[model samples]
Target: MSTVIAFIVIFGALVFFHELGHLIFAKRAGILCREFAIGFGPKIFSYKKDETVYTIRLLPIGGFVRMAGEDPEMVELKPGYRVGLLFDENDKVNKIILNHKDKYPDALIIEVEAADIEHRLFIKGYVDGDEEVLKNFSISPKAVMVENGVETQLAPYDRQFASKTVGQRTLAIFAGPMMNFLLAIVVFIIIALFQGMPSNAPILGQLTPDGAALEAGLKEGDVVYTIEGAEISSWADIVEIIQKNPGKDIEFLVDRGGNTLEIPVTPEVQEIEGRKIGLIGVYSPVEKSPLKAFVYGFKETYMWTKEIIAAVGKLITGQFTIDALAGPVGIYESTSIVAESGFWYLMRWAAVLSINLGIMNLLPIPALDGGRLMFFALEAVRGKPVDRNKEGLVHFIGFALLMLLMLVVTWNDIQRFFL
Candidate 1:
């Protein structure tokens, strides 16, 4: 139950901040926001304020911003030329006509093609249906050769996206991730000022009898400097490095009597509640300070982000297995352990998680803020936006892929925990 609560708190805070970023920006930009919802599935509670509906749903996983006309497929376009084009059964070359060609001879011709085209031509020319002129002209021509095929109609609101200036659209898209970063910073500051900071001291305060440190000639008063040739600045660094190298022989540099000596220790394999961690019979000293606390908090947060990225890279390179990845269940268990340990420990974990959340959301993957930002960047570079349907389709596919990944990770977490 504690683990579940911790998970809820962590996930809810992160998601709220993420969606809040979009909501705030949308309102600031004068965009019509129809609804702001937290969670998915059926809405348990809802309220309307200032023409916006706010909803709380059954699940506490994440939230979303529902802006007006967010879905291009559902948008109704105003009546205009209403030019319709027909394609073959396979959506190949079909027929296209301009309803009011005489009144708007200079108007640009927009063509919807079945397959994606790399380069497009937008030139003013007459279509004689000649192969060479059609190829050279800047006009897009749908090959309307077949009948009884799917018909695609161009809506007047197709220009809605292209009509917005680059800056406005960019801001609208970037607002989500920018809010995540800001929320992370704010959470860090709050935790830093209120909860204080946790420290990992290298001094060997507690040692188990006949343990690795004792067996390796490490005394209680010695200050550890390095492990396995890697520089250890704090207790956190020592714990992280040692945890990853369980049951492995390691070299340690300790300071004793104003003399530095190297000690080789083979950590004992210890099972703690079905999980394996290297046991060196050592305990890190806990320290707290006002100035060092805040600085250290930020540094620790930054380091956590770097470490996660490094782990991901290593996993991709086959240095680690996918089983190393953790899902919500794993996080909940870890959070429970931290909470049980003490307040300082919980604060440290929270800080680390916050940083991780901020960095992960910035990845250039679909269904993430980074991916949307990438699309915006492409639009800015091309001086035109991608087709809304196409872009939406890509994001939909991405979201499906991400959900599949989550399911796999969750399954792994369950197997590791119970099986």
Candidate 2:
């Protein structure tokens, strides 16, 4: 149960931050965002703020930000059609009721002669079915239209994704992945601040309760100079010596505050990944430095990012198998193990996953942010945008293929873990 909660919280945080990046930049570019959602299925909760509907959906796997002009509008006004309009104090049309007109008895009934909701923001029609005299009314930029009891705000031509500069659009798309990386760095910083950074020196920091080290009267801050007469220079050397001599007694020469002492200790034998190893259960010493903590945050993030990119490069170059990929089930299993370790370990796992998510989204595959950026790049070069129909078709196919790949990966994970 703890594992499930940890997985949900970690996954939800990751998705939320990524989508938030899109929402922030989209609004900065004056684009109309219809919904900011953290899942894909039926809505569990929803609230509207600043003309954006924030929703939490049933599925916890993925999320999206729906921006105006990214897709076709669900409702449209046609010429020569009859509709009813409600006006605000400024006499601008605030609501255009397509049906259920009785709900707003004060709404002016008109037969539409022509309407330009996007740019000109005017609705020209004959009042109350009078066709002889056509009247034109201005529409407020924030006006909404109701169709079948659903209210949808009208997005002006200047307030759309495509209407913005190519640079602005590119930033809006790239910000999602960028925000993921930033989230990882912040998590690492928090971990470092709360728990000091680990060191690699041949020194002990904390000892496990009832472990061999504590049982042997070994105290924290003991610098192990030698184990069984073999010199221990670094923590790696100590690990190698102890792990090799499982269930065997070893002599440790330690310097504890300038006092050299000889201690006999036996490492407990443990089986890990089918290999027998020894453990005295001592943690490496760490230093608590605020400046170093901030530095470690970026350093650790960069290191992990570099390693992940190299692994992805191998996968792209056919050096790695497709089965190496992990899906939700595999992540859950890993999360359970990490959760058992402790809270800090779980946090580190979340940071690693965030970095991975950031890198994967930056891959130039269609239907992803990288794919949209590719189109924007072409537009910059060609002096015109790609045809919307063609681009939409490409994205549709790419999304379908991605879903199929996810299913395959998830099935593989289930078989590997459960069966």
Candidate 3:
């Protein structure tokens, strides 16, 4: 149960930070973001704040920000179409009623001749069903239109994703993945600050209570020089020697305050990953430098980023099969395993996952941020935008393929872990 809660909190934080990046940059770019949603399908919870509705949906697969002008106009006003318009005190049309005109009895009924909601912001039509009486009414810049009993504010040309400069749009799309990387770095820094920077030195910091090391008189600050006549210069050396001789007595030559001491201890045998390993249960020394903590954060994040990139490169090169990929189920299983280790281990896992997510999202696969970036690059080269219909179709196909892939990966995970 604790592991489940940890997984949910970690996953939720990752999604929230990713979407928040898009929201921040989109607002700065003057785009009208109608909804900032987490997950897909039916809404489980939602709240409206300012210009955007924040929502959490049923599926926990992914999230998105719905920006205006990304889709076609919902309601179109054509010549000879009848509509009802409500006006503000300034005599500008504040609302256009597409349906349920009877609910707004005081609205002026008009047979639309022409309308330009984006740029000109005006409607010219015959008012009160009189064909001879032509009237032109200005629409408020913040005017809202009702369709099927729902009111949605109209998005002007300036407040749209497409209307922004290419640079702004690119940043808006890139920010989501960038924020994931930032989350990783921040989490790493937090871990470093709290736990100190991990060191590989063979010096002992703490010994497990009642464990072989503690029971055999091993003390903190004792630097192990050799184990059973074998040289130990690093923690890896100690681990290798100890793990190789489970349940066997080992001689430890240590330097405590420049005084040599020999301690004999029998390692407790423990099974890990289907193999028995010896455990003296001692922790390596840590560096408590505040500056080092910050440095470790960035260095750790960069290291994970490089490792993930290499793994992805291997995948593309066919060195690894699709079976290597893990979906939500696999992640949950990993989370459970890591959570059993300790809090710090779980945190480290989350940071690595965040970095992996950031790098994966940057892959130039359709329906991903990298895919949008690829389109933007082409637009810049061609000196014009791609045809909307063609681009939309490409994205639609890409999204379908991605969903199919996700389903396959999820099934594989379920079979591997459960069946």
1-419, model 2: which lDDT tens digit per residue?
88899999999999999999999999999999999999989999999998999999999998999999888884667877778899999999999999989888999999888899999999999998566898999999999999888899999999989899999999999999999999999999999899889878899889999799999989999999999999999988988999999999999999999999999999999999999999998888887778988999999999999999999999989999879999999999999999999999999999999999999998888899888988999999999999989988888899999999999999999999999
Scanning candidate 3 in windows of ten residues, the lowest lDDT window is 281-290
The residue-level lDDT of candidate 3 at 376 comes to 95
Tens digits of per-residue lDDT for model 3, 135-160:
99999988999988788999989998
Query: Which candidate order results from sorting by TM-score in descending order?
Result: 2, 3, 1
Clashes of each: 6, 0, 0
Q: Under the 3 Å rule for N, CA and C atoms, how many clashes does model 3 have?
A: 0
Q: What's the lDDT for candidate 1?
A: 0.65
TM-score of 1: 0.59
lDDT agreement with native, every candidate: 0.65, 0.93, 0.91
Poorest lDDT segment (10 consecutive residues) of candidate 2: 73-82
Clashing residue pairs in candidate 3 (N, C-alpha, C atoms within 3 angstroms)? none
**lDDT score at residue 388, model 1, on the 0-100 scale:** 80
Writing each residue's lDDT as its tens digit, candidate 1 over 1-419 gives 86677668777777777777778766666565667888999999998886468998998767888765565432122223233333355543234444543443443343322222112412222233332342222223333211133223221222233344667655766766566555555556556566544446776665778678787888876788898888878788878877767799889898998999998888778778998888777766544566775675467556666798897788879999878878787888788888887765665576566556666677788777678778888988997888888988888999999889889999999888879
Off by over 4 Å in 2: 208-217, 225-251, 264-280
